[model samples]
Target: MNVFSALRAFRELLPVLRPEWRGMLWSYLIGTASALSLAGLTVLTAWAVGHAVVERTPPGPLWWVLVIGLVLVRAVLTWREMDVSHALAYRVLARLRMALFDAYARSVPGRRREHSGYAATVAMDDIEKLEFFYAHTVAQLGASLTLFLASLVSASVLLPEAGLVVLVGGLVVASSALYRARAARRLGEQEQRERSALSTRIVDALGALREVLAYGLAPRIIAETDAATARAAAIARRHELLSQLVTAIRELVITAVVIGIIAVSSSAAGVLAEGAQARLSPAELPALVALALAGVAAISDATATLTRLHPLVAGAERVATGIGRAPVVSVPERPRPLPTGPLGLRFRDVSFAYEGRRPTLTSWSVELAPGEHVGLVGPSGSGKSTVIALAARLWDPLAGTIELVTPDGTGIPVAELDDAALRDAVALVDQEAVLFHGTVRDNLLRGCAPRSDADLTAVLERVGAAAWIGLDDELGEGGVRLSGGQRARLCLARALVRRPRILLVDEVTASLDPATEQAICDVIAGFPGTVLVASHRAQTLARLDRLVDVTDITGVTGVVPAGRTGGA
Candidate 1:
């Protein structure tokens, strides 16, 4: 997208800030007042010099009083303008941050895989750059134009030739902003990409620091990061050089405008028609030049602002598209309550296909009765995990309905249930279940229903987790402070703390030893809840009430293991 369109998209992404608009208006007014005061000061100083040199008299007390009063007002308005604009910018940035977070929260683990650090850069760094656009660009541009117009009008009434010079100079400065803009946008986009890529690599390396050290890949990773940084810096250097060229062109145009004004005032051109009187007297020549410079300077500042904002269009488009992305699974406008009792999930002829992957299920139908402990079994890549995910409502099936049935046989579509209610009714503990950075108590609670320490302790003990860690004990990232088995147990305990009625487990025994897996199975066996576990291990499935071969559900002939039965 072009710069203007990108800017429009970014503006649309902002929360409706009626109050900020009002603040912007005030800021614009104060800023214009400040500019006019400075311009007026410049003109008055020139006029006073002229008066002293030509009229040979001390300046009157009124002129001094007016100058002093304007200086004080300018100082106050300058500070107030900065304060209001920056405060408004920060408030908008904060709102934008929240909006971005909410958007990601709704659409995350999105159909397309995006690096977490890249997303973080968009939400954090990209949004931060917009502060200058919001605070200094819009309101300041308006103030600049107002001052320019005021000066233009005043100068025109004094000397039409000088007014013409100001208009031409303004246009010239403004045109420089559009020059080579396509190149600027390309560089900006490349720079933005490299930065995000660098961030992603850094985050990935940090996340896998253990692996890096174990495999001795630190040097390679560091070298790659340095190369990425160098590429970004090279692009930035080119961008700076182009900007300098634009600045040089703009300065040349301003100098030409000044020289043109001086020539006209000195009658060197003598191009005016006969009987057309000069508007400016000889003594007022310098003041006229000063006024014209003020007007041109205002226009120059505006052009400079646009030039800087041009490089941010790529970042703007990203943040806007990210925030505007619709969630793949939409929430219900008016949710229907799930049935009251042990929750039983039913998938009715569901079909699902991941992006760029072959269809995993077609016309797949399955049923888990209330309090039924069912295991999903099949060969690897036979859609076992897919069934668990469908049950959890991570992404809605491309076709068909998944419902929760009550003990009394009432069926409520999972899609129609409120997000909170569905989460309360169901919990999943997959092999990848994560323990966030916090104390054990924080991990257990996680803003689920409030429970006392004794209650948390009891659930931990049930999951065989209480023996190791206390409620207040801290857990590092992903529970790296603990072993894999320990992490799994703590994760299971964390899920159990929610006391969900329907538990979905996906390959919870895939990597665990026989002892740890049996302990987890024992916890599942004793728990009086509807459980659906997906596993290939015969021993793990042997404990469940029955095993539903996923290959049979999908009608994939060779996908099922040899000698596998329909149900175990």
Candidate 2:
């Protein structure tokens, strides 16, 4: 992106700082004071040295005291400024992370196509890269500019010619920030992309480590990762080289400005000409040169900060995009309350499709009576899971409405209901049972109200998991220690702990052994509220009250009936 585009991206992030304005102000003030004190110290020391050398006058005790005091004060302010700015930056980053997570929560699994690894990289690594922009850029630039302006004015009062030299040199140093701007930004973008790709690869490999090892692909994966790392390192080296080159140019400009100030002061003090009138005192020459150097240094510091921003532009843009992603479903402006009592589900003329894919459902219509147990059966890719997901409100239908129905046939569209209310009433247990790395109790209580150990144990016993798994049993990451049947049972227990009014199961029995499958089906059959199971397993379907063929449910005129017998 160009400079203007990068500026706009950063502008979008400014609102996050509204609450921290006081901290930002204090940081700027402290930084400016610290910078000015250093400049003052440099000029005072130069003036004292020149006075002693030119006029045989020793420095007073007050001069020494003033210098020592400035030293101590600058040191304290410098530390304080850093502390405040870094703290403010960490707070902003924390806020950004939460915002990004919310965005993901609302928008993700919509298309079900985003790479988990890449999304993780954007959330963690890319956001972390923005610390320099938040902590150093704004307040430090202001401090540098203030120091430069103060030094420039002092130099002009002492000698206009020296001020002119300082101004020219400062302009030169500032312009160096724009040197190779497009190239630096391009390199930065490339580096960020490479890093994200590497992160994705590593995450994918680790996630499928078993498969990688079984297929004997570990060597290939490692080789590819090494190559990616090398490419990323090369890009970083190039960026550093470019930054060093710019620094060299800035240092050269500062050096030339110092030389110009010395010449101007010498000529004005009649040190360069035999009979020239002294426009400046000999003792002031050193102070004038010091002032010019200080001004140039301030501008150089500001420019250096700007140059660093070119590389950070890519990460900033990524973070901004991630935060501003379009949610899969919009929250209602005035959400209606969920219907009272047991909640049944009805999909009325509902139609949906994944991104760039054929329609999964077309004008589909179906209903589950309150407290009824129904099974959805279809061939692979026949939209069984899609129906389950829609019932759970993972994504809104592209057309038509899915509603929560009361016993009286009053229907409230899911889209118009409050999100929390919908989530509270509906629970989903899909085929892929995910158990986080924590105690079984932690996973069970994830989104539910607090439950006593007795209550939790009762639920686990209902799912036939209490025999092997206790409430305090530690489930390694993703329940790696458990068998497939064991994981499925725990997942069921987790859902049962919520005691939801409606439970949606998607192929949860497709891969389980008959004993586990029968156990899970028994629990669903006994649920007091509405139950919708999408499965092709004969044993699972046979237990349901009726079965509906998902392939033929769409484009039906009225409430879809169980077109096929469960055992058929």
Candidate 3:
């Protein structure tokens, strides 16, 4: 993304950050005070030194008192500035994380194929990088500009020649930014990409650590991670080097300005002193030198900070890209209300294909009335799972609509219903239904509202998994200890608790034993709504009310009736 686009994305956080605006304002105020006070102290100390040297007299206690007081105030303001700004930034980070989560929940099983690892990286690491903005950008910009202006005005009052030189020198340092800004921006972009890739690889490796260990592929994963890290480091170093170069050039400009200002100020002071019939006094020498140096140094310091921040500013650009990514599916503004009770489903001419791929479905259609069970069986790569996904509206079909029907025959498009209503209307229990790293109760409650212990017990019993696990049993991450059948039953129990209007089971029974499979099928048979099963087992297919032959229709394949005997 271009700088403007990145900036626009950064501005999006303002709404969530509205509560922090007061804190941010205070931070900026404190920061400005701190910077100006420090500048003031520099000039005052210089003046005191010059006076003491020229007259051979020590500074009065009041002079020391003023300098010390300025120092104390500067320190206090600096502390306040960081404390308030960082507090505000962290709050914004939390808000951004919550927003991204909400976006994901609304857009999953996700519109396009995305890696779990990459999504995890976004949720964890990418959002953390945004702290740079909240902590530094707004307050620093305010503080830097405020100090520069204050210093410039002070120098002008001290001596016009000194002020002019400082102004010209500040402009020259700013000009260095123009020369290096483009290169820094480009390096920043490269560095951001490398960082993101490194994050993705690290997350992926960690998540698959078991697989790597099991297959003894640890060396390969390690090598890949090392390579990604190396690439990231190289890009980051380039960015750092460019920033240092900018700083050096800025310092060079400041040195030149200091020399010019001293030369002109000395000449002006001598000319004035001689005309006034007084020899040039040593007392004023250091004062003019300090005035010339102080303001110019402030400009250079501000310039250096801006240059150092260039990388972070660029990092924000990458974060903006993630935030600005378009949602795979567009949610309707005004959702259509779903059927009040158990509903039928129909797919009319529904067709879809992945981007840059041939169509998977074309002019295909199917219907299941309320409480009617249907089975969709297909060969590998056939659209059995795709059909189920489309019905769930994970992705909008490129053609036609999927509808839920009321008893009165009113049809509601799944896309038009609010996500909660649609979720209530259909449940998808896939083969890899993940159980989080928590108790069984936590995983089960995900399907519906939080349930009492009795409710959990009842669902577990109904799904025939209560005998194996309890509400308090830890599932470990991804249900590590649960066998295939146990995990499947637990997932089913989760779906059963919701009592959705339609249940879409995708090859969930494929890995279960005969007894476990029978138990799961019995639970499905007892459900009050439509049950659509995608499976290859004849026994599972035969249990359904009717068979839909996906092979006969475009975009629907691997489907056929279970012949009599049904046992395969």
TM-score of each: 0.88, 0.94, 0.86
Stretches off by above 4 angstroms in model 3 are 1-23, 55-72, 102-110, 115-123, 179-187, 234-239, 271-294, 309-314, 554-568
Please list all clashing residue pairs in model 2, or write none if there are none: none
Judging by lDDT against the true structure, name the best candidate.
Answer: 2
| Per-residue C-alpha lDDT of model 3 across residues 1-568, encoded as one tens digit per residue | 4345555656776765677778778877887788778777877877788777767788898988998899889888888877877787787787777767766655552445667666776666656766656666667767777766766776678667767877888788766766667787788767766777777777777887878789998898789888878887898888888778777887788779877866766676674445543233556656666666666676676666555545565555444545556665668999877757778888888887876667777778887777778888668767888888888777788889888987766778887888888887788899877888999888888858756899889989998888878899998979999889999999988887777889999999898899989988888877888888888877677677767766556433423454532211
lDDT of 1: 0.81
Worst 10 residues of 3 by lDDT: 559-568
> What are the per-residue Cα lDDT tens digits for candidate 2 across 164-244?
898889999998978888788788778878988999999999999999999999999999999999999999999999999
Error of 1 at 268 (Å): 12
Candidate 1 local lDDT, 1-568, one digit each (tens): 4546766865775554544777777778888899899999999888888778867877799999989999999999888987888888898787778778877877755445667878877877888887667666778889899988998889777778778888888888888888898898788778888998898898899988889999999999999999999999999999889988988898899898888888787662233545555555556777878888898889988887777775577777778778887776778999987666687878888988877888888888877778878888778988889888878888788898998987777678898999888999899898888889989999999858999999999998998888888999999877878987888888888788898999899988888888888898889876678888998887677677766878786422322234333322
Off by over 4 Å in 1: 1-3, 15-27, 265-278, 554-568
Prediction 3 TM-score vs. true: 0.86
* Ranked candidates (TM-score, high to low): 2, 1, 3
